[model samples]
Target: MSATDPPPKRRASIGARRNPASQAAILAAARAVLAEQGYSGFSIDAVSRRAGAGKPTIYRWWKSRAELLIEVYAAEKGALRAATTGNLAEDLTAYTAALWDFWRDTPSGRTFRALVAEAQHDETALEALRGKFLPERLQDVRALFGAAVARGEIAAAEVEMRLALYVGFNWYYVLTDRLVDGRAAIPAAMRLVAASLRD
Candidate 1:
């Protein structure tokens, strides 16, 4: 405690301080890494280097790589609005076409595909997808179907099945990388769906 004694260095904080700039940097870096390296090569170390932040800093904010990946996917995906054409068939076709284009042309698609792949082996990611992401997405689809029911274009009872069919159809194309080729089938599919609903 002597005056001549060197002052002890302040202990480093127990965990990384939640710096907005740092977090934004990390997220931006994560997006870049995912876009460039994809999910297979994405890692804490890679993001740490890209963001100029340390591993501990990244880990302090995101518990795992899968968690970070999910965040990146969610942030990039944002909110998608369902098309509201008066005709149910037109609305469904437009909505599906927009979705296919979004997936095929944007980083969000790859990010989501990675998230789906990660969820297969990571429970945290799976929970996020099943419990959070998927539900949010389904709501948009539900709105579209709800509108059809209100218009009497489809019975209320048919909404659930249509939702499942619509989601499954889009997911199949996304996972198979068939969006471009599948575009042609959308009109036929929507016509069939609309016909069934009307019947």
Candidate 2:
């Protein structure tokens, strides 16, 4: 190849440079597919067709459907906050109720459920759940608990145990299709936690 000759054709890098518009299109397409087709119908193939992008393009950016789903959930869920009210029990109850409402009323619920199921079989998904998603969620819980501690409602030593209990309680309700019942149950559960902390 001579310098005078046309420079060697450069191959476009795969996902090396993410175009913001293209990425948004893919995420929007993913959300549409999840909402319309449900998790069972969700796939890179489906998203590719919907986004007018190729499988390689989607795969280039999101290695697995689970990774794509995580992005979709994060985009859709946005920031979650509960009422502070300077009361631990009220804060917990409000937070749980808000979480239940989000899960039951939006596409996020199904997307999350699918992600959880995928993690059971996919190491990538499992790592994302543990390393990324759960920590973000726990941060919110910690903030709420930290507020409670500041109010002198609970000792600092109890936050970790309460955090675990709070997460497990929410997971059990969501997984069991008990979000409806969870509304009434949330206040009672919050009161129990508050009582236990006070003891």
Candidate 3:
């Protein structure tokens, strides 16, 4: 191919290059790589190779493996919409259990563990993890709690504290304690959040 030549054909994956669907294709590929390879083994070359994308494409979108993996986290975790209902306890339990199920049943959870460990050294991943991804997830849960408040099911003061309290307390379990054997844990915490909505 010469400078005048056109770009290669686009991949149908989550983060391909040149096409609008490329981003999605690449992220899917990245998740696969992260799952198979773990933190130290994940790489742009691997993801692009698997994604059928160019190295430049990965670099263009993500600054590092952590960034790419985190995006997968954001998307799968519903960065925009966490859950469907606003029943407070029902929504919280649903989303939380969904999250636990995601980690326990899929390779994504392993990648998440790696990402968490890697975040300690990489300030960029840490910032992305804390600022954007975490906030967005919390916001979704908060909205649910807010709904409960509107319904007089819970107090407004306890809304923001829901996800943190749950995630913070359960972090060790999901990260190291093992939430499931080969299936979902049902995440006992999700129930507590709902039950705690009252006196």
In candidate 3, how many clashes are counted? Answer: 11
* Model 3 weakest 10-residue run by lDDT: 181-190
| Candidate that beats the other on lDDT, 1 or 2, i.e. the better one | 2
Residue pairs whose backbone atoms clash in candidate 2: none
Tens digit of per-residue lDDT, candidate 1, span 1-199: 2358664332233365677777777898888887787778888988877776778877887777877776776676665578788788888888888777777777766667767777899898888788767886677668877888888788988877877777777778778878889899998888766665332
Whole-model Cα lDDT of every candidate shown, in order:
0.75, 0.77, 0.68
Instruction: State the lDDT of candidate 3 residue by residue for 9-51, as single tens digits.
Output: 6554445334667776778777777777766788888788666
Question: Model 2 over residues 40-143: C-alpha lDDT tens digits?
Answer: 88889877766767778778888777778888887776766765788888888887777787788888676676678678988998988987788876776688
Model 2 bad stretches (over 4 Å): 1-14, 196-199
TM-scores, one per candidate: 0.76, 0.83, 0.73
The order by descending TM-score is 2, 1, 3
**Any idea how many clashes model 1 has?**
0
| Model 3 TM-score on a 0 to 1 scale | 0.73
Candidate 1: lDDT over CA atoms?
0.75
lDDT leaderboard ranking: 2, 1, 3
